[model samples]
Structures are given as C-alpha cells and as structure tokens.
Target: LHAYAQVVGAMPRAFAEAHPKWWHVSLKVTDHGLTTDPMPLLDGGTASIVMDLAGGTISVRTAGETTATIPMTDGLSARVVGERLSAALGELGLAGDIDTDRFANDDERPFDAGAAASFWDVARLVASTFEEHLSGLSGDVGIVQLWPHGFDLSFEWFGTRVETHEENGETTDHPAQLNLGFYPGGQAYFYSNPWPFDADALLGVALPHGAQWHTEGWEGSILRYEELAGDPDGPAKLAEYARAVFEAASPTLMA
Candidate 1:
C-alpha cells in the first residue's frame, strides 16, 4: 500500500480538504484485495483505487470499465514501486509529483502470504470494533483508513477545538481528537492516541484486559495483539479499551 499511498498523496494537494480525514471511509476487503472509497477526480469524475497484493498490482478504475494497473514486482523495494507507479500515473495523465518519502524506508522483507492473511484478519477485527464504538458517538468521526506512511489502519474523532497553528501560511484549527487504529508494527497491536494531553493523568487508571499505557517515544496507549489472540472476548476487550481511554481523556483534552 506504500505505492498506493504515493498515488493518493501525489494527487493535487487541492483535494486534501475534500479528504481531510484522508483515510478512505468505505474501504473494504474484497476477495481480490483492499479497495479505496470512491474518490472524486479533478476532472469531475469519480475513481476508486485498489491495492491487490494478491495479484501484485495497484489498479485504477473509473466508474465504468476503464481501468489501469501498476505492477508490484516481487523483488522491488518500496521506493522503486513508488517511482514506477508515478511514471505509470503520468502515462495515464494522472499527474502527481508523488512524495516518495512519506514514511519511507528500505526494508527488504519479501511479501508473505501467511503474514498478509493474518494481518488482514487483525485489521478487519480492529475496523469492526472501531465501527461499533463510532456508531454510538455523536462527535465528528473520521474515516477508518489505512495510511501507507506508518502502514497503520487508523481514524480520528473530533471534539472542541483546543489550539490552532499556521501551516504553509494558512491557519488550521487543532481539535481534541481520539485517534484509533491497528498497526502491525514490530509487534501487532491496537493503538489509541488522544491529542493535547499528557500520559501522567491516567497513571493509575486501569486499562482494559491486555492493554498498557505506553510512553516510550510518544504518548499513545497500546494493547498487544499477541495478548488478545487467545482471548475469547477479544473484540469486547478492544472496544472497552477504546472507550476507557476515550472517556478518560476526552474531557480534559477538549478543555
């Protein structure tokens, strides 16, 4: 998906606001691969991008049958994939100066079928749990997206504005938000981060089953997948952990 990230990131920056929550809201797992929610093209038409790890290709399809593909060769590094994808996009008239370095690295792990299948299972479970929690909340929620940078599937929920910053000479508001996602990092886990607050406040607060408050390099909380793999109530525990952290942090973060 690092290649697909390059495609979307290369699309006109003008489309950024239209996808502020940048993760594809309707992304789903088809028998073939992971697909993006339909996106509006600069030409005023719609297209959906698909990342088919199974077929080793990134596909572009119009609302109709017209489709284009960029291959993901078995031995190519991620940077090479992005470059090839960019050239392909240019040939197809999709111009994006594609940023080749958003969470860029040169790891040489060849694709693994077993690992992919297992990771997809965890990703689906996490997405479902997030859907369950978001349905009960009235605050603004973001699309549950899989970002290529961190290779993490995440989304955000917004609350009252807490601060603002100037970016590229434009002012942007920063709201209190709870970001939730599944990441198959060095270890697979469910990660939750509520912005604008310190981890110290919840020092003694009990986490859901199999969770811990981590503050090594950042202030987010985590629950290991290794711990939940055997739990009969894994789904419930994940949702409960999300709720516990959100409820514990929302008020003060919003203030």
Candidate 2:
C-alpha cells in the first residue's frame, strides 16, 4: 500500500499546479480508496489515478475514456508498477518528469485485501473525525488529507498569531498553527502538535484516553490506536483529545 501510494503521489507532484503548502502533492480519500485530483492533459481534458484498496488495484483513467490498471499483488516492485503507470500516461499524451526514484523500493511485500479494507475503514473514520474537529474551529483550516510521503492522514489549522524566526540573517514570519494527524505505521497513533509550542504552559495540561505529552525525539501529544481499538467511545475520545489540545494551546497561539 505504501509503495502504491508513493507511485500515485508522483502524478500530482509531477503534473498538478504546485501549492505553497504542498497541498498539491497529497492524495484525498475516496469512498473506495485514495486518489489524485484531475490533472490537465496536454491535448485536452484531464486525467486521474485511483488506488482502489478494496478492489486491490491502481487505475489510471483519462477524461477521454482511456483506462489502464495495475493489480496490487505481491512480488511487484514499485518501480515496475510506476513504469506501467508512466507508460499509460504517455499513451494518453501526458508527459512530464515523474520522479521514479521516490518509490525505488525493490523489495516486494504481500498485499492482504482484508487488511487493506480494514485500514480504509479506519482511515475513513479518522478523516471524518478530523473534518468535524476542523469545522468547529474559527481559523484557516486545511482539508483533511493523506500525505503519501509519510502515509499519514492529517490537517492543519492556522491561528491568527504570527511567529517570527531568524535564519541566516533573514527574518520570516509564519502563522502559528496546530496539526492533528494519524500515522498508521509502526504502532499506529494520533498526534496533535502546536507550532511554536509553549512547553511551559502545555505540558501540565491533562489529556484523555491515555494520551500523553511526548517530548522525546519530537514534541507533541500522542494517543496510541490500541488504546481505542475496542472502546465504544473511541470516536468521542478522539474528538475529546483534539479539543483538549486546542483549548490548551489556542490561547498561546492567538494574536
């Protein structure tokens, strides 16, 4: 799944309009799986790549009704699949520098259909919860998206406050923000990190559902997915965790 995501991510990075925040490079969750936004074709119309986790396939479809599919099966390297996709795009008249090196893993991993479907279920739920949280906030909020690079689902909310940083004799101002993300890799977990984190003020605040303020390696608050696995109130607990972090950090983030 990770390999496929990387390959699919290359489409937008190579063809879509660049976003300052790199939003153009991420994939959005579809009812069936992850997908790239419609990218303009050289001749006319648009094209998109869809990774259908449930169906266990990656498909490239053009507005002209042309389609090519790559099965998500074991033993296929990312490079091989990427070449197939690149060929498909070429046949459709879309040509650009697709960085094949981004997904150069030759090691093949088994693709479990059931596991993939289960992951989609969890991702869909997380995206919904994140959207709900973002909707209630009064600020510049980003769309809930899946970053193909890290394969994490997340969104950001920019606060009114401006934080300045000096580097190489140059000063730049950036908006204070909060990020809520769910990382499905290696012991899946949810995280909320505030920019320009006020450690003195936030460390003492309590988090619900066994969530903790992590200062080692990276600073942020995290809640393990295992903690909510069988809990009936998991969604509510997730929302509460987000609210806790926002309430505690928003004051320090505001102008």
Candidate 3:
C-alpha cells in the first residue's frame, strides 16, 4: 500500500502544471482506495493512477492503451515498485520520474491486508465526520484530501488570524487555521491543531473519550484509533471530540 501511494504521489509532482488546483488537490479517496484523475502529459497522453486500498494493488490506466497492474504481492519494496512504474511511464511516454527523495521508506516491509482494511474503515468514518463539521463553517475550508507526503488524510479551516514569529532569527508570518487529520501512523491517530495555538484555551477543557490534548512536540489534540476502535460509538465519539476542541479554540482562533 505504501509503495502504491508513492507511485500516485509521483504523478502529481510530475504533472503539477497540468492541474488547476495544483497537484496536491488531485489526490482523492474512494470507498475502494486513493485515486487520481488521469493527468495530461504535454504529448497529448494521460497517465491515470489508482491505489486500490481494497484490492492491495496499484493500477495505471493510459488513455487508448492497456492498463498496467502491479500487485502488492507480499514484499514489494517502494524502489522496486517505483522502477516498474518508471518503466511503465516510459512505455506510455509520460514525462516524470518516481521521486526517490520523498519516497521515505522503500524498505521491504511486508504488507498487512487486514490492518489496511481497518485503517480504511476508520478513514471513511473520519472523512464523513469532517464534512459534517465543515457544512456549517463559512471560512475557507479545504476538501478532505490524502496528502502523499505524510500519507495523512486531512482538511484545513482557515481563520483570518495571522501571526508573526521569529525562527532562526528570521521573522515569518502565517495565517491561522485548524487542521483535522487522520493518519495511519505508528499509533493511527486523529489530530486537531489550531495554529499559533493559545495554550490557555484548552487548559480547562476535557477531551472526549478516546481523545487527549497533546502538548508534547506540538500543540494539538489527539484521538488514538486504538481507543476509538474498541468504542461502540466511535463516530459519535470522534464528532464530540472535534467539537470540543474547535469550541475551545474558536474564540481565540476564529475571533
């Protein structure tokens, strides 16, 4: 699955100029898995990629040409899969390379089908919850997207509160926003971070079941998937947790 994600990630970087919402927005998710629209090459050809989270395979479909399949047959590493994709791209005359820099871990970690299924299930539930939370907001809220870099599915709500900070003796300014993300991490966590955080905002707030206000390394609230998986009311618990965090931070963040 990780190798498949890398293959899809490369398509965006290579074809960024062809997309209107930049390459980042092209990454999408379906009940089946993560998908990308057929991207156009300068030579009037398109390379479409889909990572079948359900099937455990990466499929490349070229317009007017045969589709290529690379199965997640056990121990396929990212470099090996990338090489296959590069050869496939060459065959179709697509302009791009399978970026090795951000390919992160191409190690031969065995695939786990059962765990992936559970992760996807959690993702769907959280994605729907994101939409529910966004429906009432008037701010600039991005659609839920799966960022290839971190392999985290997330959406951001922009608030007009910008802040300036000094980093390495250089000053930088950034807009305030809240990120609600779900990741298949070491612990599989859902996170909510309000930028330029007002630490006092959540000082007295109590997080919902399965959630905690995380302050180590970063300022944010975390909902551990392991805790939610065992809860019968997982969706409700997540929604409640998000609401609690947003409510606590909105006064300072949204004001």
TM-score of each: 0.78, 0.95, 0.85
TM-score of 3: 0.85
Could you give candidate 3's per-residue lDDT for residues 1-255 as a string of tens digits?
Answer: 654575568766765445434545346777657877666766787777777766777778777664688877566777777777667766777755546665545688577888777767767777888889877678777788787767888887878887888989999877788888888867788899988778776767888885888889998889887877767788778888878888887767764
Among all candidates shown, the one with the greatest lDDT: 2
Most accurate candidate by TM-score: 2
Between candidates 1 and 2, the one scoring higher on TM-score is 2
On the 0 to 100 scale, the lDDT of residue 58 in model 1 is: 66
User: How much lDDT does each candidate structure score?
Assistant: 0.67, 0.89, 0.74
Residue 31 in candidate 2 has what lDDT? 78
Model 2 score (lDDT): 0.89
Error of 2 at 185 (Å): 0.8
Model 1: CA > 4 A from native: 1-18, 21-32, 36-44, 54-56, 70-73, 101-109, 164-173, 198-200
Q: Give the CA lDDT, 0 to 100, for residue 103 in model 3.
A: 52
